[model samples]
Target: MQSDNPEDQKSTEGMVDYNRNSAAQQQIIDSQAMQIRGLVEKVSNIGTEFRIVDYGCGPGISTINVMRPAIEACRSAHPGEKIAACHADQPGNDWNTLFGLVSGPSGYLNGTENVRTEAAIGSFYKQMAAENSVSLGTCFAASHWFSRALHLYAPNTVWFADLEGEARAEMAAFARQDWLTFLRCRALELHPGGYLLVSTLGSVPDAQEKNGFAASGRGIYRALQVVAREMADEGLINGEILDNFVFSLWFMSEDEARDPLKQDPELSKAFEIDTLKVEPAPLHQADLFADSIGDPVEYARLYTGYVRAFADSTLRKQLFEPSTNSAEDADRLADEFFHRLDGLYRKFLDKYAFEIWHLTVVLRRR
Candidate 1:
C-alpha cells in the first residue's frame, strides 16, 4: 500500500526493482565484505553471543550475499558461539521476496546450521533491538532516506538532489535530524564495543555550486520534469497534480553526512568515528554493458527500466482520477510518460556523462 506519509515512499518505491539491478549493489557489498568480516570477528573475539542487524535490508540481497557469509564465517571460527542475524526494514518492505530469498537452498540461512536469521520489521529510528544488544550493525545504501519527508516546501521537481535556497536548507535540516536519530538509536542498541557501518548516496565535492545532482548528469532529472509537463499538456494527468509531484529522496553531501555526528557532543562522546570517506559509486549500467554496449535506443531501455522500477510509484500517486480518467486510463498515461522519457534520455545520453557519488562511514561505540 502507498503511504500517506511520504517517508514510507522509500519502502513503497519497490525493492524488487532495486534487487534486479543488484550488480552495482553487489559490487559495493563485496567491496565492504572484508571490513564486515573483520568487525564480526572483532565482536566474536569478545567470546559472547554475537548479533548482526541489516537495517533497511530491502530484499535481503546484500544480507544474503555479503553479511550472512561474513557472520557465518565468524560463527564457524568461534565454534559454539551463537550468531543471530536480523534483517530490519519497515513493514511495507517486500517481505515475501525477502523470505523467498532467505528460505531457498541458496538462502543465507540455508547452510548455516549454527546461525539463526529472523526478520525484524520496523523503522530503525526507534529501538529495533534491545539496548546494548547488537554486536555489529550494517546499513548499506539505506541511511540517506529520512524518517519523514520535509513538508515545508515542494518544488517543481522530484528529488532533493536538485534543489537550492530555502528548499535545500529544509532538506538539509531533515537529513541532519534523521542522521542524529539514526545514530542515537544505533548507539543505544549497540554494545560497548560494537561497530556501526553506514553507506549512502552522495554528491561530488562542490556539489552545491553546480547544483546538487552535479555528478548525476543534470539531464537525468530534467528529462523526468519534461516528460511530466508534456503529459499534463496532453490532458493525460492533471496539470496541477503533475506540477505538485516531488520525490522525497535526499542525498546528503560528505560534510552534511558527518555534521550531525561531529556537532553533537553527546553523540560524539558515545561513538568514535573510525573512518569516513566519499568515493565513486559503481555505475552498473555503464560497467556491465561496456563490452556489448549498443546505441542510445537500446541503452535507454535498460536505463529507463532500472529507473522506472524505483520511480514509477512516486509518479503514479500524483495521477488524478476523474470520471473521464479511470485507473486503467491513468496506467496507460503513466506508460506513455515513461516511453517519452526513454526517448528524451536517448537523445541526451551522448551529450552528457553519467556519474554517481557514494559515501561510506565506520563508527565504533564507545
Candidate 2:
C-alpha cells in the first residue's frame, strides 16, 4: 500500500522512465560483467534455491544487465537449482514498465528455465527479503540517494558535492549513516558467503576542484543551478525556493565508502570487503556530442532528455510544486524549467558534459 504522508510519497517517487534514458547505467553494468561473473563463481555452498536480489532496480532495464552475469554463473556453478531473480526499489517506481521489460523477449527470464522473478517494494536501506535468503545482491547506478530528503537547506548550491561548511558536514554524516544502514540490511538478507556487488556514483580527489573533491554528475548539477538561478532572477520562480532546493543525493568518496566498515565493528563483522575501487565512468552523451559535431540541437535534446529522465520528478516536487499553488501551475513551471535547461545545454554544448566516476565494491557476507 502507498503511504498517505506527503513526505513518504515524495520519497517513493523514483526516476521517470529511467530505463529509456539509462545508457550511462548500462555502460557501468556492462563494464563490470567480468567482475560480477568472477564473484558469483566464488560462492562456496550450493543450496536448493539460488536467490539474486537487485537493490534500487529502477525500471529493470539495467537490472537485467546487472543480474544476467550472476544468473549465468550461478547456473553454471550449480545447475538445476531453482533460481529467483528479485528486483527491489521504492514503491513509487515505474513498476508497470519494469514488469513489462522483465516479461519481454530481451529480459533475463526469456530463455532461462527454472527461473522466476519477483519484486520487493521499499527502500534498499531496509531489508527487502527474508533473512539468509539472497545468494547474491547487486545495486548499480543507485544508492547515492539519501534514505529521505534531508531537512537541511543549502542556499548556495543545488548538489551535495558543491555544498560547503556545516551543510556539507551534515550531508556527509547522513550519507555515512545511510551507507551503513544499507550494508546492514544487505547483511541480514544475504546468506553467509553470499556476495553483494555495488557500483554507484562516487567522488574522487581533485586539487583544482571546489571542496577539494570531484564527483560524477557535477556538470549536470552546475547546469541545473545556473538555469534555476536564471529562472529566479526572471521571476519565473521564487528565489527562496531556489535557495532551499538541493538534490537529496550524495556521491561518496572512496574514503567515505570505506570509513563505516573501518569504524563500525558490527558492520566489519557482517561483511568482508572483497574489492572497493573508484574509476571514471563513461559519459555516453560526450560520445554523441563528438559524433554530432555540427548538430548541437540534436545533441542538446538527447542530453537534456537524459537529465530530465532522472531529475524531473525531484525538480517538480521539491522546487516547482512548493513554488506554485496548484498542480497545473507546477506542471507549467516544470516545463519552462526544462525548456531553459535544454536551451542552456544547446548554447554551451561543451560546458555541461557529464564526467562521471563510479565506485565499484564487492562484499562477501561473513
Candidate 3:
C-alpha cells in the first residue's frame, strides 16, 4: 500500500529528539499510561500470552515511552504471563535509530523477561497483524495520515484546513475514507474484547478554519506554505511544483471524528467507544521552553527542529526535480528553508500561543 508519491517521503532527518522536543506528545502518552497498562493487565488475566501492537510507532519511541511501561505493568500484575510488543510503522521509518535505542545498555525493554520486542514495518491501513491475533492496539498521532494522496492539487496551500471548493471536498472524502479504512483494519486485527487506544491532532471545537497546530504566533503550516512560495519566487524551486504541493494531512474536530461511526452501523458494531474527548490545547511545552531556554533564537531553533522532525524530506521533495536534483542539493535547500523559518519564528516569539486540540479516543472490540 506504499506509494512513491511526494507524501511518502516521511524521513526523520533534522527531527528533534522525541523525548526532548515533543512535550505535548509525551504528556498525552503519559496521561494514558495507566489506562493502557490496565488494558494489558486485563488481557494477561485471560490467557498466558498477550500481544500489543504500537501501530504507526514512529522511531519506536512510543514503544519505549508508552508500551514498554504498560507491558511491565502487565507482567507485575500477572507474574507468569508472557507478553510480546511489536512496533509497527512504514518501512522507510528510521528503524536504525529505533533499534539503536533498543540495543542500548539502558534500553527501554532491558531486563524484561518473557517479553519479546519486535519491529513491524508496513502500512497500518492494511493487515499488519494476523486476524484476531492482537490483544491491544495503540495508534497515537499517526492515523490522520492518509494511505494515499488526496488525488487533487492544493492551490497555494499545504494542509487541508486552508483548501476550498473541490479541493476541500476531495480532502474531506479522503479523510473519511482513511479513517474508516483504519478502523476496519484494526477491527480485523484485534480480538474480541481487545482494546484500541488512539490519540490524534484535532481541531478547536467550532473553529472551522483554524485546524492546524500553529507555532510562532501563526499557523506553522501556513508559515511553511509562505516559505515555499518564497522559495519559488527566488527560483530555488519550480513555481508549478510549489503551487501543486500539499502535505496530505487532515485534523478533524470532535464531531467530525464521530461522524464515521454514525454513518456506518456495521463498522460501529465492531467496537464500543470507551472515551471520546477533545482536550483544549496544552501549553506545557510552551511554558517549559520559555522557562528553560529563555532565548528567542534558540527557542525558535528548537521549535523548528520539532516541526521539521515530522515534516522533513516530504516538503523538501518539491524544491527540485528528482531526475536532476542531487540529494545534497535538496537537503541544502531544505536546510535553507528551515534557516529562514527559524528567523521569522524569532521575530514572533513573544506572540506565541498554542491553538491545537487533541482527540483522545478509546475503543474496545465487541
Give the candidate number with the greatest TM-score. 2
User: CA lDDT of 260 in candidate 1?
Assistant: 77
Ranking by lDDT: 2, 3, 1
lDDT of each: 0.69, 0.82, 0.70
TM-score of 3: 0.87
List the candidates' TM-scores in order: 0.87, 0.94, 0.87
Question: What's the lDDT for candidate 2?
Answer: 0.82
* lDDT tens per residue, model 3, 121-171: 778878898888788889877887778644467767877777778877888
lDDT string, candidate 2, 109-225, tens digits: 787788889999888887899999988889987888878766567777798988988888988888889899999899888888889998988889999887999888888899999
**Model 1 lDDT tens row, 233-269:** 8877676655445555566667777787889987998
Candidate 2, which ten residues in sequence have the lowest lDDT sum? 1-10
Q: Report residue 314 deviation for candidate 2 (angstroms).
A: 0.4
For candidate 2, give the lDDT of residue 318: 76
Off by over 4 Å in 3: 1-21, 42-48, 207-218, 281-294, 319-324, 350-354
Q: In every candidate, how many clashes are there? A: 1, 0, 1
Q: What C-alpha lDDT, on a 0 to 100 scale, does residue 326 get in candidate 3? A: 75
